[model samples]
Target: MRYVGWTILITFWVALGAALHYTLPQRDVVRIVRVFEERQDLNDWTRIFWSRPDEQSDTFISRDVQFLQTVRANGRPMVYRNEDTGWSWPPYFKFDTSNLFTEAADATSTRAAPEWYVITHYGWRNEFLTIFPNAISLRQVDGPDASKGIPWVNIIILTTIAAIFYAIWVRWRRFRRARIDPTLEEIQDSWEAAGDAVSEKRGRIRRWLDTWKAK
Candidate 1:
């Protein structure tokens, strides 16, 4: 039971970490090789990975999604889906999918004179499931090696979250120590007293039995 409880707690933390990593905004430094749009099917399980633009009524199985094709500093490929995430989970308040497409188009550059841009995005890319991260915003950078660190916005958000959780845990421990521990101690004492009384009564009954036998 102890091992099972630890396993459950570790699994929960791992899942929460993954969820936060996927939802929080991360920056990628890359050069835009191209930008385009495609009509995608959202009828399958992968639909949750895509955002519902402007909280529109969900009736369409297919919609047009803009995409940015880019090559990272290491010459590897990275593609991002450009979509609006208005009034939704991970609320970016973004409603300029078309405008972002225009900016991406203007920022496109060649390998000889590569134009690097830092893109703010959220989500994971799973080629097997055909899902891509949604690019929240972008800005042109000096070079391909502009910055590879996690954005400061994400750092602040994570720190705030950790502080909040720590505060709650401390208060909960204090509450348990102050209120619950005393009650539990009282119950334990009552249980031991009851057991002692039962043993004493059994001893008295045995003594009476011995006297009657002697008579």
Candidate 2:
């Protein structure tokens, strides 16, 4: 039971960390090589990986998904899906899917004259699952090195979340110390006193039985 409790706590924290990492905005420095749109299947199981209209997400179907194909500075391929987040969980409010696609298409460049771009996106790119990160926005940079920008937003967000959790934990400890601990201690004292009284009564009964046996 103790092991089970520890496992549950670890799993919960791991899931929360994964969710936060997926939803948080991440920037990547890459060279845009191609922009293409392809029809994709929206399966029931994979619905969480894709962004769609809240109503249509429940009923699965096929739709055209715009992809921005690019190569990282290390020559690794990175493909991003352009989509509208609408008024949803991560709350990017990205309704300009077509606009972003056009921008990606316009920004495409050849390897010789590679134009570096930093794409601000969210989600995970998994080949096995065929899930791509949704590009929130992108901007041209001088070079791969120049694409290094300070993530002040992420810093502030994480700090604020930490402060909130810390505050809650502190208050919970205070409440336990002030109220719950005293109540539990009192209950334990009462239980021990009752047990002692029962033992004393049993001793008297045993003495009476011994006296009767002697007579």
Off by over 4 Å in 2: 57-60, 206-215
Span of 10 residues, lowest total lDDT, candidate 2: 52-61
TM-score of each: 0.89, 0.90
lDDT of 2 by residue, 151-173 (tens): 88889989998999899999999
The list of candidate 1 runs beyond 4 A from truth reads: 1-8, 55-57, 148-150, 208-215
Q: Model 1: per-residue lDDT, tens digit, 1-215?
A: 99999999999999989999999998889999999999999866888898975545267788888999999999999999998888887788999988999999999999999889999899999999999999988888788778656568888989999999999999999999999999999999999999999999999999999999999
lDDT of 2: 0.91
